[model samples]
Target: MSPARSDRTRRPVDLRQRSTMAGEASAAEAEVEMALDAPPDPQAAAFFDVDNTVIQGASIFHFARGLHRRKFFTTRDLASAAWKQLLFRVVGSEDPEHVAEARASALAFIKGHTVAEVEALGEEIFDEAMAARVWPGTKALAQLHLDQGQRVWLVTAAPVELASIIARRLGLTGALGTVAEHEDGVYTGRLVGEMLHGPAKAEAVLALATRESLDLSRCTAYSDSINDLPMLSLVGEAVAINPDARLRAHARDAGWRIRDYRTGRKAAWAGVRLGAAAGAVAGAAAVGAALRRKR
Candidate 1:
């Protein structure tokens, strides 16, 4: 053989060395993938409603109170807000007209306001007013789900900023709430979509489950009003917390669990009556004055 051919024949193939390097590269690639993506939790989540479900009263009532204290609007404005809140608490969020009016009012209230400023105010107000009012039973249930390595998400029709503050204070995973549109940092007096209510909540949860690769059959949902029936039915476990009369009846008929944290039905009704009366009185006076001024 020629000298070049002899040299090529003398070169030995290091198969073991080549294999080791290839294996190392594959292992490194897998490590990088593992670092990039987290494994999805096999366990499911628990969704909790705010307002009468987690707390004793409407959350927006507290928020409005805070805004009124800060002079974000006048007492007349507060009266209008109080009237809307009373309707929400008494009649529930089922009326489309009321819903539209509430949406318009909320949009106008936050119009031109900085999102960060509103969120900061919400957090401060929550700590001062809403924190101490959380129902021990509902809160314990939420903690139980957390202890079980399941995620707990607050589902509400409230603003996302307020919902986030509540979830963070309670050490929950996150929240799904109504999205108010904003430009730069200020609210544009518009919503990105429909308010997170009724069927919208179920849709939001379904989307969340799909995104997280969750098994809806293992999830739980809790709510207080009949309007949330769609959301409650979407879950494997449905719990009615401080349910209204309609919801209580529906829960009984559907064989869902019911938790009434109120001391007594009569007392609860009495409290609602008192609040409604106060709001009506203030609202009537404000409307009367406004009409007189117009004339």
Candidate 2:
């Protein structure tokens, strides 16, 4: 037989042997996967995207808004929301760039504050932003994770300390957020961890799954933004809650659950009304001074 003919015959047999081994491995894995996926305990995990998911808008933007109400923030604070709202409005939708700009500018506002002050302000913002707009269904879904003894993690690109404070106030189980480098009491404006959004979010979820011994095949995730698609798809169940349009379309295509939490109710306006009342009193004082000056 020719040398080339012999080589071809040997290659076919080797290929068959490799294919057989691979088929066996795949079959074993299929068995294990079937077992792991077997009616995963009515227990389920729920991941929340922090910004627009749990709160009315971006959390840090709301922080800036509250600061604006306090009338002490720089123009950069308003600039945070300006470009975003304008872009989203003009296009009749949101783009990832606008969302990211809002996040970056909002976190930039953290560069100068002492940790204690940030914590205090974070608490205050939680009272205002979350009090009036926290979706009840979202919290209830969180409770469901707790009842199932599954993990309830707040996933966001905000600073970890800020996210944790918000979680504790909301009675959540855990938090996974952007980690801005910090010294004793002030931010260094550098990130300690990867930005916890988009593909980074999915990586965080996987890391948590491995650390916590979770089965991703039995996990669930919730978010409102299309940016969360990476993490949402990592789970067996992806729930699109109060979702934006892009996410809604993706969820529909994937046959995921899409829920609406917007009751069109912005009730229980907490620190907000307090801020407003304070403003009204100040306005009255300024008007009285103007009248006296005219007289």
Candidate 3:
């Protein structure tokens, strides 16, 4: 086997072992209990990817927009992030550079900020920017799992704080997300580990399964990106929701279930619509300026 493939295969085991040793596995289970009052489903659970799978767009982008509106960052920063967001929306996949840039920017802004402060703002941001963006179909699927007495968790590359807020609002069991380290209630501008993404996501699921006493053969996972193949493959049942081209093709080859919520027209016009919206905003601003000059 190629070295890269070999490493990918072994990484999950390493991560699972480390997380169990660090007590994070048990902590993840505790978070689920604290977040929900439902009866335990020790043998099965569901994992959902957050970005395009559960919501209409990238969750972190919306959170960043909210932070910009709150004056947490400059307009130049927002413009840069907006470009990346546009690319993600158009391409429907993660870009490593864009992800790194976003992580660095987020950490920079939250440095020295209290955890409570960020969590409080995350709550407001979710209400303002994220709640309305949730895909009704995806929400229904999650609800279906909940109805079946299975614990549902969101696995995303977004910060744990934001991910948890989404879970609580959606009435899910909990979430697994990239953890930014903090000390004495304040952010240290460093992550506890790598972002909960790709293989890392699979590792998290494995650790959580071990802690929660869940059977991998009974668990299901849903996602939109091919990057999540590790996580999806680790589970017994995998569903692709609004998947990108690569994932759609892979799912077909693998015989996994696929669900596309976007109409053909909607998918084709997504980038055009975003461009038109930006033009409209600029036109409105110009018209307002003209009126002010007349006054």
Q: State each model's CA lDDT, in order.
A: 0.66, 0.57, 0.68
Q: Best candidate, lDDT-wise?
A: 3
The TM-score obtained by model 3 is 0.75
TM-score of each: 0.75, 0.65, 0.75
lDDT at residue 198 of model 3 (Cα atoms): 66
Local accuracy of candidate 1 as per-residue lDDT tens digits, 181-219? 778988776765555666667767776777666789899
Ranking by lDDT: 3, 1, 2
Candidate 2 has which clashing residue pairs, if any? Answer: none
TM-score-wise, the better of 2 and 3 is 3
Cand. 1 TM to true fold: 0.75
lDDT of 3 by residue, 1-295 (tens): 9998887677656654433332353235224744336455658899998887897767776765666576565666556445543443334224444444434543544556676876786799899998998989999999988888888999876767778899999999898876767789987776665556566688788888887788999999999878789889999999999876778899999999998887773557557346522321121112112222222
Measured with C-alpha atoms, the lDDT of residue 237 in candidate 3 is: 96
Question: In model 3, which residue pairs have backbone atoms overlapping below 3 Å?
Answer: none
Model 2 agreement with the true structure over 1-295: per-residue lDDT tens digits: 9998887667545433432332222212111111233333533566787755676655655554565566554455255345444343233223444433433433443454456766776788778765777677888888887666565778775555567777777777667765555688776654443345465667667666665567888888998778678789889899988776678889899899888776542453334323322221121112112222222
Q: Judged by TM-score relative to the true structure, which candidate is superior, 1 or 2? A: 1
Task: Give candidate 2 regions above 4 Å deviation.
Answer: 1-44, 74-76, 80-109, 263-295
> Which has the higher lDDT value, candidate number 2 or candidate number 3?
3
